[model samples]
Target: MTGGEVAGLIAAIAFLILAVGIAIFVLRVAAVTKEVKQTVSEVNKTLDVVNSEMGGLTHEVEGLLVKANTLLNDVNGKVATIDPVFTAVGELGESVSALNNSTRNLVTRVSGGVVNTTKATVVARAGQKAYAMFKKNKTEQPTK
Candidate 1:
């Protein structure tokens, strides 16, 4: 071959090698892009499922809150209804305590003023004599 032809042939071969390397790089980039697209699609699908589940969970939580509010209102109403009963019970206890105090005071006053030991002894002796006479009379009478 002539010198020009040989140089031309070498140049052509180098150009061919460079083209082949570029083509291979482009194919690898395409494959990676396809994989990235598939990953994005899967991520979108997962996000959609999660969003749907969250909606249901939100609905259930709202229902639970409503029930809780109703229960709280019911309990508050019951407490209000029975509030008077507790007050009345407290009043009753106070009244009973006052009555007990009054009774104790009355007993103390009566005992301090009325029934000395001498008077009690005399009363007891009189009751015993009266009982003995009544029994004697009953025994003396004939049985009906």
Candidate 2:
């Protein structure tokens, strides 16, 4: 072949090779894009489901909070209603304590005083009887 024809043939073969390479790159890129789109779609669906579940849970938690508040209020109201009764019980306890203290003091003083006084009386009476017996013996012994 001539030099010009040979050069032209080489150029054409190079072009063909370049076209095939470009085609392969494009196909690979397209396949990767398709896979990414499918993954994104699945993520979006999962997100939707999670959102729905969270929304339901939030509503349930709100309901529980409301019930708890209501129960607390009811308990507070009952406590308020019985406040006077508690006060009366406290006053009764105080009165009982006062009475107990008074009784204890009185019993201690009275019992101690009675025991001491009785002992003193018994000693005095014994001395008087002994003196009377001595006088009788002296009068009966002699006139001298």
Q: Candidate 1: give its CA RMSD in angstroms.
A: 24.0
Off by over 4 Å in 2: 1-29, 113-144
Superposition error at 82 for model 2 (Å): 2.2
- Which one wins on lDDT? 1
The regions of model 1 sitting more than 4 angstroms off are 1-38, 111-144
Structural similarity to truth (TM-score) of each candidate: 0.51, 0.55
Weakest 10 consecutive residues, lDDT, candidate 2?
113-122
Pairs that collide, model 2 = none
Estimate the lDDT of model 2.
Answer: 0.70
- Model 2 over residues 1-144: C-alpha lDDT tens digits? 999999999999999999999999999999999999999999999999999999999999999999998997787678557655555554554555555556656877878642223433344444445445544554565441
| lDDT value, candidate 1, whole model | 0.72
